[model samples]
Structure formats: C-alpha cells, structure tokens
Target: MDPLGDRVNRNGTPTVSDPSPGSEGGLALSGTRTLLLTTFTHVLVDGYGIGLSVLLALLFGRNGRFALVGLILSAYTLATAFAEPLWGRFSDATGRRGAVVGWGLVFASASFCAFGFVSPEGPWAGPLLILFALAAGAGAGTYHSVATALVNEVTSRENRGLVQGINNAGGSVGRTLFPLALAELAVVLGSPGWAVLPFAGAGVLLGLATVSAFPLASPRTFRAGTASPSPDGPMDRRFLARMVALSFLRTAFFVTAAGFLPTYLVAVRGLDERAMGTVMTLVMSTGILAQPLGGSLSDRLDRGRLLAGLLAGSGAAFAGSLLMEGLWSSVALLGISMFMVLMTFPLLFALMGDVVPGNRLGAATGLVTGAGGLAATLTQATVGVLAQRTSPVLVLLGLSALGVLSGWMAMGLRAPRSPGGRRALGS
Candidate 1:
C-alpha cells in the first residue's frame, strides 16, 4: 500500500494505531465518539457565548447606549483576544483540555447569572456589566482555543478536516440560533431577564457534564508515534506571519459584515425591519452546510489553495452584492458571500494544526486567534470611522478588497508536508 496517501491498518481502515488510555482492553472508541462529545460541548458553550451579544441590548439604555455598547463590546473582545494565548499555553502545560473547557464554561455561565441581578438604572450597572463582559469573554476565549486543540489531538490528520468541519458547524449553529431563540423567548416571557435564564441554566448543566467527561487527569489521545518521521522542516516565521495576516483578513471580513449589514439593508436597500432580519438569518444559516462541505473538500484538496479559492469566491460574492438589485438578488449574493467566507474557517484552522508541532497546538492556536482578534478589532474600528465619513457601501467595498488581499496571501503560503512525503496531518 502507498503510505503517502493514508495510513491504514490490516483491515484497510484508518484508525488510531494504539488504544487510547482507559479504553477497555485496548479497544478505543471510534473517532465518531470523540467528535460527538466535543461537538456537543462546543454547541452549548458557543451558544452561550454568542447569546451575550443579545444581552448587550437588554443591559444598556437607549440614551448613550450605542457608546456604552461599543465600550463593553470592545472590552469583551480585548479580554477574549488577550486571554486566548494564556489559556492555550496553560493547556499545553497541563494537557488538561477538558478541565480547561469545563472551568471556562463554569465562569462564563456564572457571568450570565450575575447579569440578572444588575439594575440598568443604577450608576454601578454599566461598570458591572463591562466587568461581566470581560469575564465571559475571557472564559469563552479560553474554551475556544483549547477545545480546538483537543479536536486536532484526537483525530488523525487524514480525518481531521472532516472533524473540524463538523466541529465548526456545531459552533456556528449555536452562535446563529441561540440569539434568535433568546429573542423569541423574550417575547413569550415578557421580560428579557426571564428569557436569559435558560442560557445560564444550560451553561451550568453543560459545565458539570464537561467535568464528568474528563474523569482521569489524562486520557490516552491521538499523538504522533515514535515510528513517524519528523516534520519536513522547522516552523517558518514567515509562514506564521502569513497565517496571522490571513486570520486578520478573515476576521475583518466577518466583523465588518456583521457590523454593517443590518444598517445597509435598512438604509441603502430600503428593506423593512422584518426583511432585514430575514436576510441576516439567511446569511448566518448558510454556514451550517457550507462549513462541513468546505472541510470535506479540504481533506481531498490542497488546504491552502482551498482557502484561497474560498476567499476569492467570497470577494466575488461581496462584489455581486454591490451590483445586484432587488431583494432576492441581494439575498442570494450575500448568502453566497457568507457561505464562501465561513467555509474558510475550518480550512484555516486545519492549516494551522498541520504547520505546528502537536505539543504546541494549544499555544499556536491561541497565538493566531489572539493576534487575529486584535487585528480585527483595530480594522473594525477603522471601518466604523470610515463609515461615518463615507457611505456604508463604500466601507463594505473596502473590506471586500481586504478579502481579496487575504486570498493572495493565502496563495503564497506553503502547504506543510507530512512525514513520508504525504500531506501534513494539518493538511
């Protein structure tokens, strides 16, 4: 058999060579089990995290609300951005991915419950809310980086792409749906506070489950065997820089779209509130299918090229939105743009895993995520300023240009080769 394509056991199925520690009699559960547990946890935690965005409206006032929201959101983003690397490095040191995720969920959930007590009328309310945002953002940030590292750890490179796709889809579902669900609950419950209680409750329950999921301090997990050859070359600083640039571009695209799309729909397109909501929903929901499809393709194709192509597609779709007329045409173009953009996430993450050493997965993930967040924050602020000076359409066009530039950067990145001249596990 050609080892360069994929590693297979005697029966010709790809499986981890050795049984994970604690499996009964050397019988490890299939990667399916790994994907299920991790993905479930991801949905719950990420749902809760995204739900915080909804809470911002409930927690602040109409007067000075925009400024206050901006301040708190910036605090949250900064907290998450800075905390990712620290928690990632800590996970690498302890090799306790589950525990890290568990604690992160606990603290994040507690922050939600704390919000219930905050009186928006009181002077202390705004300060307390900012603090909560920071804490919640920190926890969610920690959970995100470590959990991704854990996913890469348990799956072979040959199968990692699909697993990441599934994993990303789960998180995207949580992020997209949770806020809408909360809005619906708010209508039925007649108070935003009552609506938010379920999120806190779910977080607590999920936190306990995370604790149980990691009974042993350490479990046997996917690791490169001694018989495997070393990476073809040392980590390249230039390659790292390329990744950071790509991440920045990706984040900028998302933040700008999310920040401005609603305004554009209402102001430029003459859409009513109902139509605007529908368009936004369609944009996010497209990712549920797009992510998995992209991941599956990444497994069979060159990841770098796939990412570049996706970015280029996203840019073209964004350009389409500029020229398209009528409601359906705009929706279709924007949806395609979202699909193309969101699909790049799993591919970019898988590429990062392939380029770095296994032991350093947590730190590497943290560095890129953190740096990307910071860069995106700066870029978004610049766009906000630009939007004030120019038209929203103009601002969006500039952001789309960034996407094309990012695709070019991705095109220049080297695909790391796995041992035996095959694709890297990250590929």
Candidate 2:
C-alpha cells in the first residue's frame, strides 16, 4: 500500500486505498491535525509577506523616495518568484515538506528581525535592505507549494475544496491582522523599526514551535510506494500555458491594487498611518469570508463561470471606488472589489488540484505562484515608476481595466472531464 493511501489501478486511473482495519480513525485524526497546523503556520508565512509592504510604507513615510522603495520591494518579490519553483521541486523530491515549512519560517523571521536593526539613513542601508529582503522573500517562498502539497497528500478528494478554502482563510486572517498589529505598534512605540522587531519575534517563536511539533504530527519518512508518478500522465502543455497566463494576470491586478494600498492611502489619499492601516485591514478582512464561501460555491457551481463573474465584479467595483468622492464610500467599493478578487484565489488553487496529479502538484503550484510573484514584481516596479510622474490612482485605473480583461479570459476556461463523463468542479 502507498504511504499516503493512494494507488493506480490496471486501467491507469488513480484511486485512494482504504486504511487498514482499526487504522482509519487514527489516519483521520492525523490528517486533521496536519491541516490545522499547516493552516496556522500559513498565517505566519503569509503575514510576513504582506506585512512587509506596510512596514516599508511606514519606514519611508509619505514624503520619502517612491522609486527607491519600489525597487526595494521588487527585490523581495523577485527573489520569492525565483525561489518558489526551486523549493517546490526540492519538497516534491525529498518529501521533507515539514522541514521546508518550519525552517523557512525561522529564516524569514530572523532576516526581518535583523532588518529592524538597520537604520534607514545609514550609508549601508540600501545594500543591507536588499540583502535581508531577498533572504526574507526566499524563505517565505518555501511555504506555499510545500505546505499546500502536504495538506493535499493527507486530504480526501471530496473535501479538498473546503480544506483549501479553510487554509487560505487562515492566510487572509494573517494578512488582515499583521498590518494592523504593526500599525498599532508603530503608534505605540513611535517607530516602525522597533514595531517590526516584536512582530518578527513572534514569527520566530511560531517557527520554533512548528519545528518541534510538526515532526511528531507529520513524519519525515518516504518510501518507494509514495514515489509513483501521477496516473493521469503528464499535464497538458496547453492547459499549463493557460493556467500560467491566468495566474499572471490575476496576480498583476491584485499586487497593483493591494500591494501599494498603504502608500496609496497615505501618500495619495492623505490618510494617517493608523487610518491607512485600518483601511488596509478592512480590505483584506473580506478575504476571510470570501475564500471559504467561494470554496463552497465552487464545489456546487461551475468554477470557470464563477471565477469569471467574480473577476468582472471586482473590476467594476474597483472602477466605482475610483469615481467615488467620499473616502468611506471609496473604501466600501474597494472592500467589495477585494472580496470578489480574493474569492478567486482558492478557486484557482482548487482548480489546479482537480487536474494535476498529486505527485506533481508541488512543481505545478510552484510554477503558477512563481508566475504570480513575477507579475507582482513587474507591476510593483511599474507602478512605483509611474507614481513618480502621475497619480497612483491613474495607474490603479489601468490595473482595473486589466482585471476586466482577465475576466474575459477566464470565461474560456473549463474543468477537465472525469471518468464518469461529467465535468469536475475545478479544472
């Protein structure tokens, strides 16, 4: 029997095997524990990733150099894009998924903590910032593919969508809370640098905890039975291309809108740091509800059409937000846009799970997320440069237009057919 309880029949179809008598209950408990732990750690990893942007905005202040800050931010994203596939491949090969997750958290947290000690005005600041940011990004990049694959390995197909949604919701919670916590800390501590230390310290503590606990919960053992290739054969090249394109455009839209939101609120909207943080928290909080709901809906509806509608709705809402005169009204519209856009994340991931074989999931996920990270890097660089000459709001309007185009592209996507001659929930 395969270590993960999966096997291929003579007809080449993959099916899960039943656990040994009396072992089923233990397996279920183990899987649940793994899911919960992975989800919580996801909170730390994603929190550091998103919260870094807010920290940068706080450090630079409203009147600081936009282009330089953009380059610095781009370095972090570019490093992450470059490292994701490498980490994914490694995890897939070694089956050391827990090691990647645990160590990555530690390394990234330590790097960020080191960053807190560097004075912004010092001569060595630029080089040091880039170095630490790159380290942090690379470390943070290890979680998504490896951890998601770990979760998928243990979960049953019937509940996969809901499981992914729950995991993703944890990330959204992190994104929502971490920035607010940092902003509140800045207010109380009177310095962004000092504020970051405590947050990073928390990550270190969590990393240590994960490292200690994960080994007992998720064994590091790998056997030949678990090394079989996917029974579905190699993934279709055309499908890979389409998924990559969708991932790229979706990420470009998200990063352009949300990545720079703090700067946009502070520099463009003239909001104070606390108010900017609050608005950002509000915008990101929508994902907590949106992802799980979308996950449930995806299981019941046509995922392609649902994703298309959500993307289109996000574009329209974003455009409406730009036209609103009142700050709160604009915030309300932006929140709606965020809600719709965030829903698509789990849908896309679940779609990938539906089509890709379990053995190759890590590599495939790495590729898609790497593309998204690249898009974020490019979009951030462009937005930063453009903001120097024009209003950030104008650049955001352009992104909103692209979001609509992404929606049109999504309309053509279809889920793969199952052996029963019915379309699957995700393709």
Candidate 3:
C-alpha cells in the first residue's frame, strides 16, 4: 500500500480511510464508537452550558430581575473565547486533543458542581458564579473545536459533513433536553437551586463518559494543504476576508432567533412552559436534523450557494414568525429557520477544514468559533435589550432582514480555490 493510500482495513469491511489524512488504519467499530462518543460529549457539554441561560432567566426573573441575565450569558461566551483557541492550539502542538478534552471534562464537572454549590443568595455568589462560568465555558468551547477537528481528521470529506452535522445536532438535542428538564426540575422541587443537582450530576457522568470515548490524541494526517495558515496565500486571502463576516452573520442570525423566539411564543402567543418548551424544541430539533443533511448536501452541491440559501432561509423563517398566528404556524417557522442555520454550520466549517491544514485548523476554528460566540453574545444582548425597550417582533423582523441580505451575499461564494490548488497545500 502506498504510504498515503487510503484503504479498508481487513478487520473492518466497508470502512474507509480518510483519504485526506495520513492515518494508517481504516475505520472500524472503534471509529464508529469514537464518533458516537464525541457527538454525545458535545451534546452534553453544550446542554449543560447553553441550557444554563434558560435556568438563570427563570431563577432571576422569577424574582423580578431579568436585567442581569445577558451579563451572565455573556460570561460563558467570554470564557469560551479565551479558552477554546488555547485548548485547540495546545492540542495541535502536543497532538493530544483527547487529553485536553479529558482534562476539560474534569473542569466541566467541577464547573457544574460550583454552579450547584454557589448560591445567588450567598454573599459569596458573585465570585463563585464567575468561576462557574469560566469553568463551564472552558469545557463547552473545547468540545466543539476538538470534536470538529477530530471528526474531520477521522472522516473523509465524503461523509465529513454528515459527521459534523450529527455532532452539532447532538449538541442541539442536549441544549433542548437539559433546559426543559431543568425547568421541570425547578418546578417540581419548588426551588430553582434544586434544578441544579441533576445537571451537575449529569456533567460529572458526561465528563467521564467523554474522557473514555476518546483514545489518546495522536498525530493524524488529512487532505489539507499546509495544515497551517499563511497570510500571503491566495485561498487564505479569501478565507481571511470571509471568516469574520461569516462567523458574525451566522451568530447574529442564530441568537436573534434564540433571544427572541421564546419571548415571542410565551409573551406574544401566550404559550405555557410546556408549550414554550415544545416550540424551542421544535426549532432546535429541526436544526439538529438539518445538520447531516445539510453537510451531505454541501458535499454534493456548491457549498457557498448552499450557505447563502441557509442564511436566507433563516432570515425568511424569522420573517415568517411575524406572520405566525398559532402554535402550528409558529412551529413551522421555527423549524425552517433553525434548519437553515444548523445545516449551514457544518458546511461552513467543512470549507474551513478544507482550506485550513491540520495545524492551523484548530487555531482558525477557535478564532472563528470565538467570533461567532462573540457575535451570539452581542446579538443576544441586543435582542434582549430590544425586547425590553420595544418588541421582540421588531427584533425578529430586523434579524430576518439581515438574514436575507446575508443569503444574497452567500450566492457569490466560489468553491475555495487555492492560488495553486493541490500544489498550494502544505506550502
């Protein structure tokens, strides 16, 4: 076999070596296990972290202070920004993303425990909450970056999109389940803090499960160029120009939905908790489902055009929310909007993976993820403030308009061409 040749291992029929990577072996049951485990880890971490916002709002607003909610939410994003790239960089440099993530799980578990132990009523709450946010953020951010990189390293582009989508969907599912569970838990126990225990316990189990899922991170090769970045390069020139804007627009549209959708359902439409949860679930559920389909579609279609359509669809979905008259109508709009966003995500990341080499992939993804998270944070704050000062309907509408604009622009994305195609790789 050629040193770089991809082949099926005798032990695992139907398995494909990632043709792009230098991995010696073929996929096996072990490979499938890795994928499932990593995806599950993503969902759990995301659920524990993102779902906290919903719980926080409930805890704080139940007492008549919804003002500080965005601050608390932003703290998590801030932690993600600071930690994600550092973790990714370290993983690449040391070739130990698994260890990094495993250690991160330890932190994630500790974060939840801290959240459980720290009381808003405690005089010591402020510092403890900060600690919790940092710990939680650190864990959540690493999961996506590491998982994405790991997936790309292990899978061929042929199915890479599907894998990324499944992993993302898992995270969305976690986000959906955990919050609703916490909401129910909060009600049943008659104390918001009581809602904390289940999530905290789950985090511990999840951390251990995640650590066990990954083998020790080892050097893997892929069909990437230099696995690093060069400012002087042509493809990177386009990527550099595109990354921030793409990340910003993606998050802006997403948070616009997240920030306002619940409020719209509950406030304007008068959906109860169960109903509200159902609506949120539907939107995210669609997004989760959309991931693999979208990725695979991108594999077959022009990715740039697909991204444009996804963004535009998201915008239109938000626009449709204004016209939604009942639960079913709201559900439809929510489903379509989220599907657009979720499907677009893995495709965009795949593009990044294609252009970025193994070494730079982690760093670039970390930065873009940070940019997206930052955008999500800002959009959330803006939407919340707007919801407070005016109407969620208006905010949703404005965001929808932006989505339309982004889609129009996305139509122009050409398949990323290196100034020199294969020759430019690894230069």
- The TM-score between candidate 3 and the true structure equals 0.82
Query: Compared with the true structure, what per-residue lDDT tens digits does model 1 show for residues 189-294?
Result: 7666687687778777877777666533323233233122112346667877888778877776765565456556655676544455456667778878888888
Model 1 stretches with alpha carbons more than 4 Å out: 1-31, 48-50, 54-69, 113-126, 218-234, 259-277, 322-325, 385-390, 422-426
Error of 2 at 194 (Å): 2.7
Q: Rate the local accuracy (lDDT) of all candidates.
A: 0.68, 0.76, 0.65
Q: TM-score for every candidate vs. truth?
A: 0.82, 0.89, 0.82
- Model 2: weakest 10-residue lDDT segment is 221-230
**Model 2, range 1-427, lDDT digits (tens) per residue?**
3223345444433355544445432235445666777788878777777787787778675774566667777888888888887888887776667667888888998887777667778899878988988999998888877777777666544455667778888888988997788898888988767877876787787777667655422332222222222225677667667888887888788866777778777887888888988998998999899988887788778788898999989988998898888999999999999999988877787777777776687888889888988998898888888877787678778879868877887887877787789875444
Strongest candidate by lDDT = 2
Candidate 1 lowest-lDDT run of ten: 222-231
Residue 30 CA displacement from its true place in model 1, Å: 6.8
Off by over 4 Å in 2: 1-27, 214-231, 425-427
